[model samples]
Target: MKKKNDENVLATNRQARHNYEIEDTIEAGIELQGTEIKSVRAGKINLRDGYVSIKNGQANLSNVHISEYKQGNIYNHDPLRVRRLLLHKKELKRLAKEVDQDGMTIVPLKVYLKHGFAKVLIGVAKGKKNYDKRESLKQKELKRELQRNFKLNQF
Candidate 1:
């Protein structure tokens, strides 16, 4: 009963990796309406500006945009409504504790389908400083150069 293949990724937030150091990742289910799932299947979603916040002891994902379904009727949901995340109570509490600490936040890394259900991969991340970003970039460039040199030597 799966709509998307296991390898199909609906959306990803590359900026999350660039801006944050992800210490832990967790997969959680999402609450979506009928039209929302259609939109998600069509790959009409953005996770770049989305974040999960704990409110009233509940985890709510906000600012994630799921475009309106083209064939949706009047019952279509609001494109930017806050969606609830399905996670165990203990997990939620653990996340809350981490997020409560200084410089720790929750961010959505990607969205995909798992076993016919919409799932989101979230990360417990700490923000990277400007110098850290530059250092990471330098390391990436060095790795690329090493790979290129290796390929040329093999030829």
Candidate 2:
């Protein structure tokens, strides 16, 4: 049997990293319904446009898309429904305070299954300027070029 410590990533928000500079990350459980979990396990989830919102001291996930389970008839869940995130009181308070700061927001980084439960990795991030995005792209290209050159030299 596989160990529960192993994590199976379902979906990742690649745009989040490019658009926002993540400062800190936290792992929180997702309150998924029966059909929702089925869809998630099938890797039919999209976190690209998803974000986290703290309301009334609770964290809610919005805009995340989990496709309906084909086998589910009337039991299918809404693809774009707002789901509740499970977090500790202290963690929720900290996230709320951080979001209250100007330019700081919470974003869903990735969704995965851990220990038979769905978990989301949320990040505290600030929007990056266009210049910053360009610089990052340049850095990535440079790194790729360096790796290619190194590989050629090894042959």
Candidate 3:
């Protein structure tokens, strides 16, 4: 059996890094039903294609899939429902302005339990062009090669 970490990370969207250039991040509380939280703790959550949107001064999380709990039976929540994100009004306004003016969008980076409350780490990010993605891959390869060479020299 796999051991769960004390840190309690439910899901992480590593692909967000490859697809977007994140500029700012904030922690926001997510509204979840009992079964939804159960599914999250069991690590059946996916944020790979998830995104955030602000409508009517409220932030909403979309496309973040939390699989139904096996034991939930009739109490299971929808796997792909749009969940409400709780944030300060001031923060919402600021995010809305930046998104409108900068053409950036919000994306969930990771979800975890904090102080027994489910929190999501979200970022304001601009989508990367194809060329930008390729360049990032090239830079990552260079960094890996440098690290490998340094380890060899230390031997």
Candidate 4:
């Protein structure tokens, strides 16, 4: 059987890192139904391709897929429904300000179980240009080569 941690991390948006340079992060609580919460606990959630949008001065998450519970039928929540995120008014204002800047966005980084409750790690990020992404890739390759050379010399 897998470890407990395997069932804890429901999903992570890997594209968030590659597509944007994460500037800051904050944890937020999400409003979820009973079945949705159960589905998340069973590790049936996807954060990739999910995004946050502000409507009427409130933040809402969209495109997040939380699989239906095995036993849930009529009570199942929509897989891609927009869910509200719990944030302080001041924090929401700050996020709204940041999002108003060009190329900046609010994205969910990961969803995980915290003390029996589901929590989301949201990040304020700025989209990177093609050249910026290339530079990051180059830096990664250089780091890998340096590590390889050091290991070979040690052996």
Candidate 5:
């Protein structure tokens, strides 16, 4: 369902946060074929393995899967096709520069529909170390415990 802000989240890459420390996020429009957008609207899209690559001054989304529309015929789009992402020239240059840093990469955080257009939220991220991942887990558990205790005390 679309929110008051006119965004309807379709798919999220939950593992992206667990594996990478996001430095920044940018929203970019996605170019989808007719059948592909239909599959996306039906929630048959997966962003888990998607990443953004900037090449030839353009951003491309790779490894994302949008299943074929069940009702689509011979012109159905490819499920794992690399799609183009639309970003301004300045944003594209910035993203390209950010990705050139050591251990830095661009990952797709989520796919959502905004104002009738398909968009992808891409993040500039650095892969977390094993220790960093464990620390984050510990912090999450602590936060959960605190929330539970607070709720108990409220009653």
Candidate 6:
């Protein structure tokens, strides 16, 4: 049986939008142990403080917390271990080049199950300045107010 979208989930980092401007996205496979996979299936993962770093020419996800499976007494995975992200050589090289540029970063946007396999959505982003963030907030508020006025006029 398949789990519902809302169920069998762990955690999500919603703060990515507030901190950075996402430029592009890529899906990468997460290398997991059997116990860790089970724990992820049960929705015991956290990607809030998670980040991807290049080490020895490879990408590794750090600070991503995958909680220990309750049923696995002896073979449970560590909750805060670094997990490898699978990507093609070409993609890896591209990401590496982009990250080498100033203000560019790699952020894991979301972790979800696809076709019974766990997948992560990673975004290449640039940090937004304080003025940029404030402008975005102002635009959002103006849009909301316009919507509200439109709805009131309709009624």
Best by TM-score: 5
lDDT of each: 0.94, 0.94, 0.93, 0.90, 0.93, 0.87
Q: Which 10-residue window of candidate 1 scores lowest in summed lDDT?
A: 1-10
Per-residue CA lDDT of model 4 for 11-91, tens digit only, reads: 889889999999999888899999999898888999988889877878899999999899998988889999999889888
TM-score of 5: 0.96
The root-mean-square deviation over C-alpha atoms between each candidate and the true structure, in angstroms, is 2.8, 2.3, 3.0, 2.8, 1.7, 3.0
Regions more than 4 Å wrong, model 5? 1-7
lDDT (10s digit) by residue, model 1, range 1-155 = 64454477889999999999999999999999999999998899999999999988789999999999989989899999999999999999999999999999999999998878899999999999999999999999999999999999999
Task: Kindly report which residue stretches of model 1 are placed more than 4 angstroms away from their true locations once superposed.
Answer: 1-6
lDDT (Cα, tens digit) per residue for candidate 3, span 43-75: 899999999999998999999999999999898
Error of 1 at 145 (Å): 0.6
Tens digits of per-residue lDDT, candidate 2, 57-90, equal: 8899999999999999998899999999999999
The better candidate by TM-score, 1 or 5, is 5
Tens-digit lDDT track for model 6 on 79-108? 999999999999999999999999999989
Candidate 4 structure, TM-score to reference: 0.90
| Full candidate order by lDDT, most accurate first | 1, 2, 3, 5, 4, 6
- Higher-ranked by lDDT: 2 or 6: 2
